[model samples]
Target chain A: MLEQYRICQTTGLRVFQSTENLIKANAVVAVIFLAIGGLFGLSIALTRWKAVHLLPADWFYLALTAHGLDVLVVWIVFFEIAVLYFASSVILGCRIATPRWAWAAFALMLIGALVTNVAVLMGNSSVMFTSYVPLKADPSFYVGIILFAVGTLIACFVFFGTLVIAKQEKTYEGSVPLVTFGATVAAIIAVFTLASGAIILIPTLLWSMGYISHIDTLMYRTVWWGFGHSSQQINVAAHISIWYLISAVVLGAKPLSEKVSRFAFLLYVLFLQLASAHHLLVDPGISSTWKVFNTSYAIYLAVLGSMIHGLTVPGQIEAAQRKKGYNNGMFEWLRKAPWGNPAFSGMFISLILFGFLGGISGVVMGVEQINLIIHNTIYVPGHFHATVVAGTTLAFMAVTYLLVPLIFRRALILPGWAKAQPYLFGLGVAGISVFMMGAGTLGVPRRHWDISQADAILPYDFPGAANLMMGLNGMSAILAALGGFMFIVVVVGSILFGKKIDASTEVPIAPPEDARVVGEYGNEDHPAIPGTIALVGVFFVSFILYYFVNWKYLAEVWPLR
Target chain B: MSVSPPQQKIWWNEPVPKSELIWVIIAFIWGLIMFFAMVWWHIYGEQNLSNESYRITAEDFSAKTEAMVEKYKVREESGYPVVHPPPGEDIYLIARLWQWWPILELEKGQSYRLHLSSLDWMHGFSLQPVNINVQVHPDYEMVLTITPDSAGEFGIICNEYCGIGHHLMLGRMYVVDERGN
Candidate 1:
């Protein structure tokens, strides 16, 4: 029998209980947002393939707006909040600072999401959520942005409160637990992210209402991207934390190096927050110098961190399988790995897909000149979908199978199906990504209601290719939708109809008994803080300080009027 | 299709296990091949533009003469609009959403390449008769090589939003034959 960790209760409250509930609540919301996003994407595919604007151009724009907010903003961010809470409270062996405040924060974000979604559906603001300047929308959209920001900021505060209390309580030993450590870093960035939102979005909102006559698009774009790009990093950082979680759950493993993993995560805090200039690479106003520094060099730091994780992941699998007594050649452990484990398969495939379609494209597209051709192409969304949707979102889904029984206190309703959802979604996503690459390469632009309409001005033979790609997109999207729906059924059914699992019978993953190994991070005695991240942090902050002081001109003309 | 499993083998029931080195080597080779394929495609594809033209518009084309024509009111053998712009000539064409502005007005047997660009924001410029979708970016130009394979009133609509009047940004391209050709 495995030695299960006891879920101790204090004052009639389970420490892990609240975080699990929070995660489940957020996941349900993620699923709903996912469904809405998937539907809109399907419509887009239909519009392109069938060459019919099933919805009007206005509604399609509305759908596009809702899709961005719901999937990119609501879906991912909300899930991050849940993941953060879990990382802080349960994974760190600490409790939420005030569970009430956390719950209240969730409610606030939920309400904000509702308000924004309703406003979008009403066509009050189809400004693409980006709400780029000069192209104005109604006051409600801006208000929705403020409300959402406030909600997210408050949630960050709750996380901060939790972290401080956990620190005082000394929940874990010297270094923070890996998951909590990562979540804390993301929460830290959230402060800057939220502040940037206020800096730009609030003033822009005021400008929209004519409170202030005008705000330059250039100035607004910079600060807004401070919020925008940094928020994406938060998503990515949070995603990496989930990678650890999934590895442990699916493979019964731990990260290869505790210090190295933490270092990678911490690098995100220092470097990635300033890498927002990547998006503005092709924008006319920003200087090539700023673009080069921000897009290429700064981005490489995050990529390096990811690379560390990538290598470390395989290292972990090797170590874990070695523990399983696979004593053959170096690669024999890999051969013995639990390939049938759906979560494991999902993680590997997601890693591969994200690395190629997401990471490589992120670097390539960030190039200033290259972005001129592909900035507004469908490729942008394609890249994000690989990282956010394929990588992080799927990783979280994989974790649910392990977490549901522990958190919900029930076994998965259909464990078999739970196992299959990951690969199905992965395959479906890969197919969609491959198809979209075709559209993007040909410069088939994004945000379209109908391709046939555009085909009118294009040469006669071009629509055939575009339409063919769209058809592939449509097919893959439908497959993804089906996969998504299957996940919903499995997840929701697990929560509702699952068999009761006794808390006393939890499965435990402990280091094997054969060999007593020394911790590499601990100086043969205790855990050591890796120097890489701290050193990088110093350089990143110094670079930012230098740039802000010297290149004040970039702040003004970045976004263009 | 999935690999069929036999026995209780750890990774498929093969006695002679596949080497990881093999996988890595194959991956490397595949990467190289894909890189070369892409480079070849990009270089060769752009250079071989049989439909290349500086400007083909609605004012300078006629079917009666084999030489370069100066009026769009001409039909080609395929029976469609042919608006050929002579070298060094700049022209502006007005169009609404959801309609095609044919360079050759109801002229059939036409095959011509047209340069499309939107005046403001983003617009989808397509020449029916020939299935082409060239994005009429506000500032950048897109080339469309269209040979109207058939005759019909091919409709056009704005794929991207210009403004509230976006839906009515429709145009029509009529493919018809000329009397002489």
Candidate 2:
């Protein structure tokens, strides 16, 4: 009788009341913010394509500002938070830590998002979102940043509190659950992320308040990016964790090298703290040696983590299929795996595309000599689109389609379209990225509203090789925009109107005593193999958003016109 | 709680077995190889480490536009004279927050290396089509060398967002392959 009560409107997550439904509802809300960022991607491309830099100087800076904060910072981080919550609360079999606090965090973030959006739209925070002074903006913009950071910090505290409780209760022991492990690592990184924010936001606020005499532009840029770059790694770890969850959700498969994967995630936590220095490689204030080491060693370590996953995830997939008795040729496992499983297939395709273009391009962009050509150019944007926008964010979107309904006991609405969105964004962003690479080769700089009049090298008159590429970037954004709209519909519809199903009995609904170590449950026959893995699906991470600055990634000549 | 309790001792929690000690050693050795390889390329890598240096509007293009602006109400900090071509330099190169002019200029026979850089927010000093660029922080030093083998006007553009005027940051270098005496 008690089990049956779990299925009713009073207790079950029938769209809204239950924690599961509430969590999915929050995810849908966050997606709206990400969509705006996605749209800005196209706007930027079009601005460059027409060589118009089109929006008025102020409006252009506003859009550029929103594009950076909204898309780059907010989109990925919020999505990561949502997914992390779902993984911890439902997937790991725990009640969300203080459902009220979670809602408060959401409210604070939502309000912050609104305030910042309005401020930017009104041209109050047009300092390119970097808060680099000499370029001033209204005070509200700085306030908005502070509020947002506060909300995020509160969310982190809430997450940490729950994990501590989970560990003390000893729900399970030995090794932490792989998804939880990955999340814990991301939370660990959040300590640095919040610390870095305090470093940047506090000073910026001081400057905004006129409480400080000066905010040295060079020092500010360096420290800000330290916070900036490391946060991306957080996005990365979470995305990988989701991939692990996705494989389990769809295929009942676990990772190939449990120890190796967990170690790699921990590497991100230990190393990425200092890797933020890579963003300042070209800045003159820092020494060349510092730049070289930070770029090559620090950033590369994180990049190596991606490389490992790139190789390992597929290897596990292959091995799993093989174990399942698909004894065909080398590529047969690829064909045999369920492409129809939205999370698994979508994440797989996103991975392949990002590996060559986003990952390697990011590595190249971080190099001392190579950073010169690409920094702050369309190429800079292109590189990141592949990484953050295309790579991390897309993974999350895909995973959400599967996890959301499952958590809420709602059947997916338009599961077919849910599957299609990934391919669309992947293709569109690919086109955009290639176009940006061409522009980088041709020398088109980023962050300009219009290039049309008598301009400089990437002159409004003639953009050279980048001319065609910029236009192509616009087309890519447009295509991706369409895909983004479809994503909104599918995700929102799944949570709101889809038919309801009972949360699986096989799937645990209560928070386990321990989530630190992952092991199989039930039956010695299968023994769940004590299978430990971190293969993920539906983790939405983004590459394009990270490229919003283009300043660190590109370099331009002195004013020519 | 309807959910089954998690199993004990997951694979990830297990300590490395003795058999894998050799693998760790091999991994260490491989890491050393990779690190050294990158260092070798970095310290003495074969790249287009060569470039040419020339100023735009080098007294030669000295368009009277130099007088285009009203006489300064005051002298700038350099005190090099509120004069157009500051003493000791034959060029009146005017670069705004984000762009440069006359991207190319060179003597046909004279071999020269351009010391390129920025004077503000990290600007990109790049020669398009070739991966020759670097960040030019204001108060930072930059050195670029280019040996123009032939006579021609090459395009130069800023690839960084020094400011809103970033896209217009363009410069040129014309190699007078053989500057007649």
TM-score of chain B of each: 0.47, 0.50
| Top candidate when judged by lDDT against the true structure | 2
- Model 1: per-residue Cα lDDT over A1-561, one tens digit each: 211233632111134556666777876787677778778767766655664446767777788788788878887888788777777766656666666777777787788788878877888688775776655777777777778778788778878887787679876555555667778788888888989988887777788789887565456667888988888888777766666666655454555455456667777777787667766654433555566566654535665676566555555555555656664654666667666665676676676677666766665565443454445556666777787778877776666655666566666766677777877888778777777766765555566655444433333333467667778877887788778888878878877897866645544422333122222221332212222233324433443343233223222211111
Using alpha carbons, what is the TM-score of model 2?
0.80
Which portions of model 2 show Cα errors greater than 4 Å? A1-22, A51-58, A450-464, A503-561, B1-38, B46-95, B98-122, B129-131, B141-151
Q: Tell me, per candidate, how large a share of the native contacts it keeps.
A: 0.01, 0.23
lDDT of 2 at A427: 87
What DockQ, between 0 and 1, does each candidate earn?
Answer: 0.04, 0.21
Q: Report the C-alpha lDDT of model 1 over B52-93, residue by residue, as the tens digit.
A: 223222223211221323443454433334554432233334
Candidate 1 ranges beyond 4 A from true positions:
A1-17, A51-54, A454-463, A509-561, B1-181
CAPRI category for model 1: incorrect
Best by DockQ: 2
